[model samples]
Target chain A: MKTRRSDRLVDMTNYLLTQPRKLVSLTQFAKRYDSAKSSISEDLSILKRTFQERGIGLLETLPGAAGGARFIPYMLPEEAQTFINELVDEVNDETRVLPGGYVFLSDLLGRPEILKRVGRLLATQYINEDIDAVMTAATKGVPVAQAVAQELNVPFVIVRNDSKITEGPTMSVNYLTGSSKRVEKMELSRRSLPTGSRVLVVDDFMKAGGTIKGMMSLVGEFEGTVVGAAVFAEGRVSERVVAKYTSLIHVDTLSSDGTGITVTPGNYETEVYENNNLND
Target chain B: MKTRRSDRLVDMTNYLLTQPRKLVSLTQFAKRYDSAKSSISEDLSILKRTFQERGIGLLETLPGAAGGARFIPYMLPEEAQTFINELVDEVNDETRVLPGGYVFLSDLLGRPEILKRVGRLLATQYINEDIDAVMTAATKGVPVAQAVAQELNVPFVIVRNDSKITEGPTMSVNYLTGSSKRVEKMELSRRSLPTGSRVLVVDDFMKAGGTIKGMMSLVGEFEGTVVGAAVFAEGRVSERVVAKYTSLIHVDTLSSDGTGITVTPGNYETEVYENNNLND
Candidate 1:
């Protein structure tokens, strides 16, 4: 259809990134630059191939009837750190979150860039695992799980405090929320996962292993395997997990005066490799 | 190096999908199949091309040092429905969600299969929209955003109500949330988007377009253009914008009647034609 060979990819890539949350297929991109679809496909082929060379961005395309390619500008941790640092500055509002010991990021969980970067960093570590699915509890954890699930190229399932719209009946377990004052019930579709599926459970916070345990019980009911468990933040009873996993940041609220947060290996690409023997 | 026969693209594709999150170098896949990197590359070339042709999956390959190939398995709506329907049936908590006038889908959002299917379906329509990036508010919306991001090969950004430790500092805004009782503050980072960028915003709910307005404002602050905005469910007070969009399901909630939901055009793929319109 159309063609622009000289520096088309970089410009096209930039053009696509400038318009996040939309799609621009091969034919359209071809027509935009005045190149043939085959030639444009060649350009996309180069762009997509280059993505895996570095741990950033993905070029996805659909096939047949309504098919075209779109570019996802995913940032590697090195790239992600810049934004994370900026976000932390906003979170420095110590007074508002002091009562809870941390800012309630439940609201922030809905933002896209932060979650995309964070999720990729986590997924960059676990891409080779026998990860059957990404699991999380309601509200906050969904974003994190979705990011990781995307990075891992697997499915993500959510657990709930109660039955709500969008689902039928569920299999649930009691969980003592870390910051909240109640024993919340977490539920999953009994038939969603098959028997002996390998699952990785994740959440935004884990003060006690209570929520983790509850999810573990839910997994147990389905005869699924809890291959790993993780959290974006950990507080108070950090060491209470029934097993070991990863975390991007560790919130050690244990030592009364020294209550602080330190990032952990769980959040890094190294942990994913080490745990899955990826480096081997 | 490794390589398969001319038509063994499917096997190669599956082998890569089963591997998940790992970056498989050209040498690795080449060696596994006993083919030259060039030959493997050709196969991958075919795999990526044909995989999309079959509407089965995507192949993203990293070039140069520390690079490899990754396959993400996804399906269009027609294929995903039956599989997801079974899972939906298992989640048969019809009673609990009636109060919210919705099904309790907080958990299904986390399931990998459901997310994979839904994300792919929604992404098909926008795949050729020349989208720059994929945007979604946090929590439950993350997975949906991730699936779309992966399918489109773009970055997904998450906004927040309040910044967390993971995020250092942030750009803040007070937007009206869904149909909640009050207006909630939403936050994003200044550098998360490029000025004059085109962004697509996706979310799980759209009660009043309050938070969406805030996100639109956030896009404005970045000098970015909103290419489109969509939600999985309809909001309380709906207003049409330049790119106002809905999803597979629409939620209509009245003060007296409460909530009503229906499926929409978010499923079927958008038709894109080959611009064979050439010289006279």
Candidate 2:
């Protein structure tokens, strides 16, 4: 399993980029390279130097018991936003994406790498903002919350569709959802959120603003305030409330046919990149 | 924020060891230490060499637009596995953590630093398992997936409860959700997953295995295989598959009385510490 330094780093980076937050041990790398442990060490040094010189990514090493190395991708906020906006434009299919006069974002969330980028794009915006925790409804919105939470170094909370024994006592709310005439129930962990917390709301879709409003109520119950809100896709249903917000992609239905769908991100990437406040 | 180098090295090693898959930037460390970037780099080099000398960990760095550094905590497969089993033991009851039947993982997830360690703990086990991707049902699982995916450097795919228009055509599978009772639908994009892919299934809870099985079915439709399955907590409901799996913590029902829950983590740390196999 002997390979050149260039070969090892290229293959290692490719292997690492494919997996999102997982780790590989030096022993494994050493085995894969069929080289001595000392040689593997040398290769890793070259890889790290290569990374710093390029400014494209970051590599992490874990030490002591239960330790290894992992790689995390860090894009220049502007560069990332550009990619996201382009992706949105490229995905513009007036017929398939925009339906019933709304932009659709389901396709974007389904792609893992793309979702990470989108999440990062949104996170880059709020990192400097005074948001305390990220919040989203259970099920679809979790990925976005996860992505944002990672960057902000904060815990993200989820509102479950129903209360479970595991969740203990919960605060409940009812709200109008999308086209549904009836109000649906949303629950939040009474103990999970603290009072006076600054919350950043995230979700997969925005239909009637019922769920977000419902979460707002839950936040209120906890004495928390909504600092900001964002969604993967926002439907053309009436805007729920006037608040600071952004969208990774937008959905719209322009024609009579339900097949009409167009997806474009709001000015999210541009706004964040222009701020250029990436200094930690 | 001033700390001794020895303590910092140990702490840093422990911190990075848990998230073997994500990269950390020098800027971030420098900020934490109020130290110059150059000084931080020097410290990292010293730490990196120590790890290489001891055959303990690997420090990987990304280059170009994705530049940063990551500390990967790795253990041989046997050891990595043992560590997961040992985690079940650290469930603290006297820590006032119990609120109802749940072990109250909220505290763990709420702390970004702790979450990073937990992510590293899980990532070490799945490294070389030939997993093409990481899969988790939405909500709490998203963060867990994100944490591990950051370490693994692989794409993490999240399944959603409801479909949004932006995803275009989607394929859904009906699964029994114990929480909701009635059959519910979880969806993925028709194009996101390929046929016969090897995927690692992860989630926050394991109840009846309905969602997991359904996810397996969805993967099968694309000819994908489940390389491994993991859970943050194994709760009241029994698992659907008797096959081998990994879990950070195990939640057992002490009694039907008020949803009595007993928390335990298997020998996760010990497993990681003991195995010396594949020592290159």
lDDT of 1 at A62: 64
The candidate that wins on lDDT is: 2
Q: Could you give candidate 1's per-residue lDDT for residues A12-44 as a string of tens digits?
A: 544454343246776677666777677776665
Tens digit per residue, CA lDDT, model 2, B135-206: 887666766776666666566777777775545567788877654467888887765666677887888777
What is candidate 2's CA lDDT for residue A255? 45
What lDDT does the true structure give each of the candidates?
A: 0.58, 0.63
CA error at residue B3 for candidate 2, angstroms: 30
Error of 1 at B77 (Å): 9.5
Report the C-alpha displacement of residue A15, candidate 2, in angstroms.
23
lDDT of 1: 0.58
For residues A28-113, could you state the per-residue lDDT of candidate 2 as single tens digits? Answer: 88777777666666655555554443444456666543455665555665567577677767657654444455444444554446
Q: Give the TM-score of each candidate.
A: 0.53, 0.66
Residue B243 lDDT, candidate 1, scale 0-100: 44
Off by over 4 Å in 2: A1-77, A93-107, A110-120, A178-182, A237-240, A261-265, A269-280, B1-91, B94-107, B160-188, B207-210, B236-240, B259-261, B267-280
